[model samples]
Target chain A: MQPTSFENMFKDAFENFEAEVNPQIWVQVQQQIPTTAVTPQASVTFSGVKTLLIAGVTAIAAITAAVVYKSEPKLNTLVESKDNPVDNKVEKTVAPVQSIEKVLPELIKENETQKVQPAPAPASTTVLKLPETTNESSANNDNQASEPLNTVTNQTKIKESEPVVEVINQDDKHENNLSSIQNTEAEKTKETEEIKDFNWGRISNTFTPNADGKNDVFKIHLPDANYFKATILNINGKILHEWEGENGFWDGKDAGGYDLPKGMYVYYIIATDTNGNTHKTKGSISILK
Target chain B: MDEQQLVTNCLKGDKTAQKQFYEMFARKMMGVCLRYSNDLATAEDYLQESFIKVFGKLSQYQFKGSLEGWVKRIVVNVVLDELRKNRILFDSNAEVTDVLQTTDDVVSNMEAKQLLQIIQRLPTGYRTVFNLYAIEGYQHNEIANMLQISESTSKSQYQKAKIQIQKTLKAQTII
Candidate 1:
């Protein structure tokens, strides 16, 4: 039987019609298809390692933040002096060492100059409370202080030769036993170099946008920049928001000023330093109530 | 390459052949997925999910029909499965609207995107049935079995969907 004119019109339009599909769909599909094209075993192992690395980085960051929170007065000076150039490096180095020592005591011993007294190790309860206190500040305030610590942790992980693999294994071990394995002084210098190069903007992983004035907006903490441009994208890789200049921020809303649901969003930033060097960084941000 | 060779290479875990196979059908399948979904994001989700299923179940395909037809069915089923999870299609009360006069010339003049937008604005029940019966060429009884709805309901949903589309087209002064 012949189709009606109405049915024929739609079929004619859509039968051979091709709609534009997002390229990100192919990426997600590739990640999921285990048995075909990509080796299932290899993808599984790689993702497993990635998850472990993220967990290890997060644990180190938490421990470091907790320790820094414990040594409140000294770090308080460091946090306040974040406005000054003199104390920025000290604050960055000390925070990371405390956290790294919790996971790798031997590594911290190499940088004993920046080490805080490890006697008052923070309890698990203290570790859980640290993020809350930090979250109380504005997005630029707390993230400016805490975000680099995670970057340092990640950079340190990359510098060590597969030690993250061993770190995971020795996670439950006491700190004293971790100090047995000595890391070369050369590696410490390399880590310092990596940290020095990452002076560009850093963003927080999560922010609360319930309009409490504290962290109501996701801000990129760029100390000095002639040019800055950032684009925020939803999971589908669609651009939701875009901003330029150093003071630009996203208040958990789309370009239309609609509140986006709380979920992980991706941000791509390109900042041109006063020296004409460009810095590019991309990471995920999560919106919370 | 021919279909048999491509399928064989894909089954043997050839990355190039798998990508070629995907590039070959991704557009057409995305069209099918878009018609069944409300937005590009949801359509993309169904498209990716269905392709994953297609690749996984490629071994089960007996080369009994056209590979495109086989893949399209999988894409449609994935969308229906997702809509079923919402469970709003059958449970929501059907709203009544006047059946406005529609001209085939008006719909034909509309760009494919405009037509797609009109289809997307349809209520879930009417949209699903309209896609299955009008676009996918499924009979009402077959759609009833697929959606687990009464055949009469499928017919009425399609009719209501047609009226809704015509109403929207009329409102746009396209007719």
Candidate 2:
């Protein structure tokens, strides 16, 4: 046969032909060859992962702090006062330190020189209660009757840190108990006083809401009215504002918007002392704008 | 399944697809190995080695051309590789027969099975060159490169294989 005929026949016969393949051949192939499953490469760097974790942690901490600030906003009230002019006015008008009991402390300081005791122990927070007197009738009352106040300093620490503090407003029943224990429990401690006499202390006769760091509030001086509910009503008896405490005072506002107009507003105080004694007294505060 | 899918499945280490892949090409690849090998056992060894290499290098095979063609090339390389390792052909340096110029009558005269038997009977040198140039259609230069021989040597071995096949056919009285 010619070489050309031979090559053609060879290609035709065997190109697609299959011989018997041993089944065991595949087993040998499988044993020798590794599986081609996916192999992971080292892709992510360590610092990249660390940055992600740090970012996540910072986000969580910020969210938690925001939640805390929102829930207990009063905790930031001190800090916010400096930034907010409106809040500055509000604070001057209603800084808790201006207790209705503390009269013009500068005048009290001046009076103390003449009234100093021979003990020379200095002016103190010790006193029988001052008589209750509102700013309207304050002209009739002796504004300088009491000695200078020596606040058992930081007494407000007992509850809210106000210079004038009524930690827990009690009735007259607790008054005797309070006086007997006053030296032992009331000092380095905040406690109540008597409800026997309905008296007024040095009342600030004018509430100048000028935010001038002066008398921007009406200090209603119902000193014996522990456990009291008091409302400031208009001349029409329209209740403008209401406040209560063992001894509480009010901001010159209606508790919401602008300050009350410069005029007389009623201060109606109904006091229930620890002794269950209830006293109702109506007075007025003149807002001198 | 298409050749590309079959290769992909095999690459994924799916044992069933691997088995199926073997099933699809095993017989044909064995035919190629058998021509290059001395016996059924040796041919089976080459078949296994070829398949292992086929799976190992599957990822390197870009699926642009025929997948079967790619696999067939791997099987052929495995045969040549085994021959080179044993080195029986180079050791013998057997004489080249004067059968290069003969007609194709002898190879054509035999049955396909008989032709395969006679081809396997040729010496390793002649047999591999014949399988590459004749059945596999590789040029003499390619065969020379594959067998690590000169182009003349590849031609000589192929001619000698033809003479051996012709003699076997004459004895069997096929031509």
| TM-score of chain B taken alone, every candidate | 0.92, 0.88
What TM value does chain A in model 1 reach?
0.32
In order, candidate lDDTs are: 0.66, 0.57
User: How would you encode candidate 2's per-residue C-alpha lDDT over A1-289 as one tens digit per residue?
Assistant: 1246676788877877789876666665776555464543312322332343346643333323322222122222222222233233323323443442163455334323323322222122111111122121122112322222111111221123331232222222233343454343322121133323556455554578788978766655556645666677666544566666634566678745567788888776666545434454566788887
Error at B78, model 1, angstroms: 0.6
Q: How high is the lDDT of residue B21 in model 2?
A: 77
Scoring each candidate complex against the real one, what DockQ results? 0.32, 0.24
Tens-place lDDT per residue, model 1, A1-22, is 2358998899877867887777
Q: Which segments of model 2 are wrong by more than 4 Å?
A: A1-3, A39-289, B91-106
Lowest-sum lDDT 10-residue window in model 2 chain A: A149-158
Per-residue lDDT value at A78 in model 1: 35
